[model samples]
Target: MFGELEMVKALLDERKRVVVLTGAGVSAESGVPTFRGQDGLWKSFHTQDLARPDAFESRPELVWEFYNWRRQLVAECEPNPAHHALVELERQIPNFLLITQNVDGLHAKAGSKKLMEMHGSLWQVRCTKCTHAREAREPLPDMPECPVCGHLLRPGVVWFGEPLVAGVLKVAIDQIGRSDVFISIGTSNQVQPAASFYQLAKDHGAVTVEINLEPTPNTGLMDFAVHGKAGEILPELTTGLRESLS
Candidate 1:
């Protein structure tokens, strides 16, 4: 399925605006656990349930405990070659945007400058009362009180039943709409709005690529569906882009 590297290179060579959307699969290669993976259960509770506002309201400690555990897990991971490759790709492309569904901050650690964490970041905290957000560098308490409002602080991520932040979503959609090439890496394509971006970019005439370990629901719609570890595939693919441009 990856034999069409030449075609992708052609698009890169054209210097078209490119946008990349990544998901948990990209971080999975670096040892971060996926939200719905088999091992995601904690204390007999589904990881998904622990991320909701209702969950936090009912059991804030449980939610914070889950996120704290996840934060530590993410801290243990380092950005792999795929993350580095995307950083280099950003450097090489003048019109580029790196958007991710991941809450992990690995992409930023890899030096991607023009990035949007559409799902928010694990290294941030939002006030439950005032909604003011601030960077969180250290592990927080189970009931970290927001200094700004004295209310509880919540994980700075879009939870189940919550809408994606308007500004972040707008930027992602704008870039996808204007991009000439859109690549989705390691996403399951089951999440909406984000999942719909591939089709949006395709409809707007972008050449789309799906790079994942396996084909997903959106694979059939891609101009290229290359199944493999993104850690391996992305570096090789970007290497081709670099060599072709050089």
Candidate 2:
């Protein structure tokens, strides 16, 4: 672990282009609940059931209710040390990108300017009728309306069956291709596209690293796999990067 940490620190010290991919595990450290496993049930229905376009089309009110609950819950949680560590990394690296699958908005709250919320955000809403979307942090009505088209509004997240926003995916891939250092943090590497990002980075000759609570399927692909809590590990890494700069 010590050797891996030093290797990653050296990469950061080189000031090369870096890309960091994060998932629910990072937000989990911030007290945010993941919408998977035993904790995914919400009022007898699977959280996944409510997070689909079909469900929203059938019962917009119910979908909004679930989303409202999630928004409120996430709002109560604050960004943890891992989130702040990424912010510091961004400050030090001139070419850096953070692509996150979680929509808790903690990264933005932690002051990450070069961030791509690939799964969208809990604090955003989009029009169902027309192409209109915006960040809406305040508690929304059970069935909010599009101020532009007067149609219903839905949570701006990318549902299970939905494809990721094309533009965001393109940018993320481009960053991965150009990265000199690629780090996967707190992701299970089970989700598509994102799950394969480290491989793409490797193909581009970037050094790949993984930091998770346990081994993921992509662990073998990582040049450095450090298993632990991201909150504990990331701050130490950021401190090392800082000291290296000194």
Candidate 3:
């Protein structure tokens, strides 16, 4: 972990632009269960059934129940070391972007700037009928209605069948396709859009680095793959980079 981190740090020091694409692995450090993991509350319900737009239409109360539960869980968790490291990394690097797949607001909580939430955010709400969305101040108790259309509102997160927001996706692709360096943290590379960002980065001649607790399918494709808990590894790597940049 130490040796590879220094090597990656050397790349970071030299790179003009560094873009990061992070997955649920980054937020898991903060005690948030991933959407697909057995520990996740979604175990009882299939993600496709609960998260889709059709599901919300058919069962408004169920959709609210699921999101409300997730909100409660997120409310309990705080940003962990991995989240803090990214914020610190952003502060040090002059050209930087952080793209996160996890809907949890841990990145913002850790003070990360230049962020793109590709999968949407759990702290937000969007009207099922209308396209309006907002950062919610209070958690949903009963099935809430859209203020504009008086239709049911659901979590703003990207569900199974829904497309990623085009504007946000376009921006993420633009950065990933042009950065001099790209780092992937804690994602398994099983999901699309976010997984494809790595290849896009590599396609554009970016130095690629992966930091995770264990290697995944895409491990072999990365320039460097460091296997360790991201919270522990990222802080160490970025801490050195911070001092060096200073």
Q: Backbone collision count in every prediction?
A: 0, 0, 0
The local distance difference test score of model 3 is 0.86
- The true-versus-predicted C-alpha distance at residue 26 of model 2, in Å, is 0.4
The best candidate by lDDT is: 2
TM-score of 1: 0.97
Candidate 1 — which pairs collide? Answer: none
- Candidate 3 residues lying further than 4 Å off, grouped into runs, are 40-43
Better of 2 and 3 by lDDT: 2
Give the per-residue lDDT of model 3 (tens digit) for 123-178. Answer: 89888677889999586758888889998777888888889887888888888888
Ranking by TM-score: 2, 1, 3
Residues 1-246 of candidate 2 have per-residue lDDT tens digits of 788888889888985799999999999999998877987999999998889999999998999999999999998999999999999999999999999999999999999999999999998899988999999998888889999989999899999899988788888888899999999999999999899999999999999999999999999878999999999999999999888787
Question: What lDDT does the true structure give each of the candidates?
Answer: 0.89, 0.93, 0.86
Model 2: colliding residue pairs:
none
TM-score of each: 0.97, 0.98, 0.95
